[model samples]
Target: MVQRQQVVMFEIKKASEAEIAERGDLADKVADALARAGFAVHRDVNDASGALGAMAWADPADDSGGGVFVRWLIDPAFSRAAVQSVQQGDVESAAFKHFSTVTEQMYAALLAILTSAGFQSEDADDDMSPYTIRVKG
Candidate 1:
């Protein structure tokens, strides 16, 4: 019964030109693998001047008849609690809790998305690390 949702932010890692060439088909590989694994993910490769990042988004609104009940529960919970307030519509939310269950599991989701894309990552975060990436449109 859901219609729309927001994608969480993600980052790039270990992707150099030589690496992409060696794994030239990685972009398609990443996208397809994620889809098959039940995450409707998207990938991006970008660079401006000397800065760069690779990012992806999983379809947070998917309801593909799996009936597992967990993803169904998690989707609306996250959107209502974390995403809806920030979509520039009206209500403003408070600061994100980087250590909460939502953020913690989101980190796991990011790991899954990135690894599928052939990016090797240790992908750690302390209090000093960013809480969310906010992948640009």
Candidate 2:
């Protein structure tokens, strides 16, 4: 039997028109918060097409094949932030367990950071996507 690979995504929703209008500024603040929390942050240079920005960071300890790749993107149209996580290699590999473990830890950390920064959020419903967290600001 083939096991399907799973990708986890979290959406940070903007609550009001004022928040949406200042998405770029909000994204910058989020990036700064992530950086301060020790996540490697890079501003997306190709944002001219309307995306606010993109960021990627990984577990510093997992330099090998065990690490998961995480990305953050701010959508200009919706003024929402999406955080995605995917394993680096084959889904069936033994390292998948490690990937899941690390991914969960990263997600928890991310949620805590965002919430402590004054955003409202909730865990995804069982009927919704697996391991998803929806955040609202």
Candidate 3:
């Protein structure tokens, strides 16, 4: 039986700006991270004003924090596995550890990818949440 393990949901939030720009930087970062992690991920975006800017721009890492709004969401299934980590009682450790094991040192890689692209990432103080990413520009 394919175990029905919970999978974390991730997505880049809709970029809503009175000004118009595709705002696909977050998606690019996600693709880089996932690619390095060996997941063939992709991204796409649209301006709330009906502006179709960057189409299919590395759609990966979902609904998360960046630049006063954008965010890099980690999947919940992965998040829980990270929490209940075999290590137990050390969720933060497990969160990092879990993704690390799956993607061969993915956390740092993702962090680097996000930061280099003007996005800042912070691990949650509480293990119950996923890491947050903020964009500088």
Candidate 4:
């Protein structure tokens, strides 16, 4: 199988005025954590005219899952891979496990980083919800 790169993203939402003023510091802390994990990280501010707050992307790790799969599920580009995985059954589960593991790791690291920095992080549990986006913590 040809390995495909994956990128996992998370958004940091400002819960209060204090958090808003310290956006740069927060981004630095996040990037530091991601960088240490061997991922090339990038930070974007006011994405979509502040509707999405700040966004971060980490380079793909081995066998990780990215939005590309879900985004292109209907496209022919993914049909071959998807069909093969469906035939095997376990491939999807294995991929999800890998994604969850990395996500949890990053989530824990970010939680600790944010809390230590005196920022109150949200945990609404909805990825598309207005609440802050966390990996899984």
Candidate 5:
């Protein structure tokens, strides 16, 4: 049987004007970290507002009992240049191509980046939920 595991979740909030400038760079770093830790990362965007984001997941081929996943959403307030950068696309593609089952390292790296940037952790309670990219097997 296939079971899904929640490794980590970040309730990312909208970025302010000044923080928008750094969103692209931070996204790139997170994507790179996920790739290095062995995940198939996918770059995504919000259709309505065009917010950028990425998702990474553990591969099933490795015979791990459960799956691990991580995803994040960039603040919609970010500029178009940062939201639609060629570098971001390339980095995301490269990360997506890396498929391995090692999930702990990816979780640690991703958690570090998000927490360092002051992104909120997921709320166990529903009433306090915030904007986020949720990942699950």
Candidate 6:
């Protein structure tokens, strides 16, 4: 079977105009936090292929054949981050299931980390459809 990637988008909810004005700095703070938690931060496409803004990858030591990638969107009007799993080679049903389970665990852990870093975050939907996280600034 073909492997499919799972994505979790994080949208920042600005608390004030000052927060909105400091979106770039906020993005950098998030990147720093993730880096401290063992993610490799990439600031350019050259650092990470096809990346439009900042990108980060979970440590290779945590890879279960599929690693997690995080893209930090620095747009002033709509700052956000997107976390996703790297698609792996085609595999059997059992392997695919294992990958999905592991990916979910990784997502959960990431959410916890973000929240612990003082970002008020929650899943956009109760059932987690679309896998979006609303982060309060």
C-alpha RMSD by candidate, in order = 16.5, 15.5, 12.5, 15.4, 18.2, 15.2
Better of 3 and 6 by TM-score: 6
Tens digit per residue, CA lDDT, model 6, 1-137: 99989998975443454433454455566678778988656634345444433353322221221122343423332211112122444444454555455546655765787789997656545253334344444
Instruction: Report the lDDT tens digits of candidate 4 across residue range 1-137.
Output: 99998998875432445433354455566556545655544454323232211244322222222110000002232334444565788555654455445445655655555455454554435455322333311
Best by lDDT: 6
Instruction: Please tell me which model should have the higher lDDT, number 1 or number 5.
Output: 5
Error of 1 at 137 (Å): 27
| lDDT scores in order | 0.40, 0.47, 0.44, 0.41, 0.41, 0.49
TM-score, candidate 1, is 0.33
TM-score of each candidate structure, all chains considered together: 0.33, 0.43, 0.34, 0.36, 0.30, 0.45
User: Order of candidates by lDDT, top first?
Assistant: 6, 2, 3, 5, 4, 1
Model 3 misses residue 120 by how many Å?
6.8
Q: Give the poorly placed runs of model 4, Cα more than 4 Å off.
A: 1-41, 45-92, 129-137
* Residue 20 local lDDT, model 2: 40
Candidate 4 worst ten-residue window by lDDT: 65-74
TM-score leader: 6
After superposition of all CA atoms, the RMSD between model 2 and the true structure is 15.5
Model 4 TM-score?
0.36
- Backbone clash total for model 2 is 0
lDDT of 5 by residue, 7-126 (tens): 998654444444443444444554566556554456443232443344633323222221233444344543333435445775254333331112334445566655554544331222
- TM-score: which is higher, 1 or 2? 2
Error of 1 at 135 (Å): 18
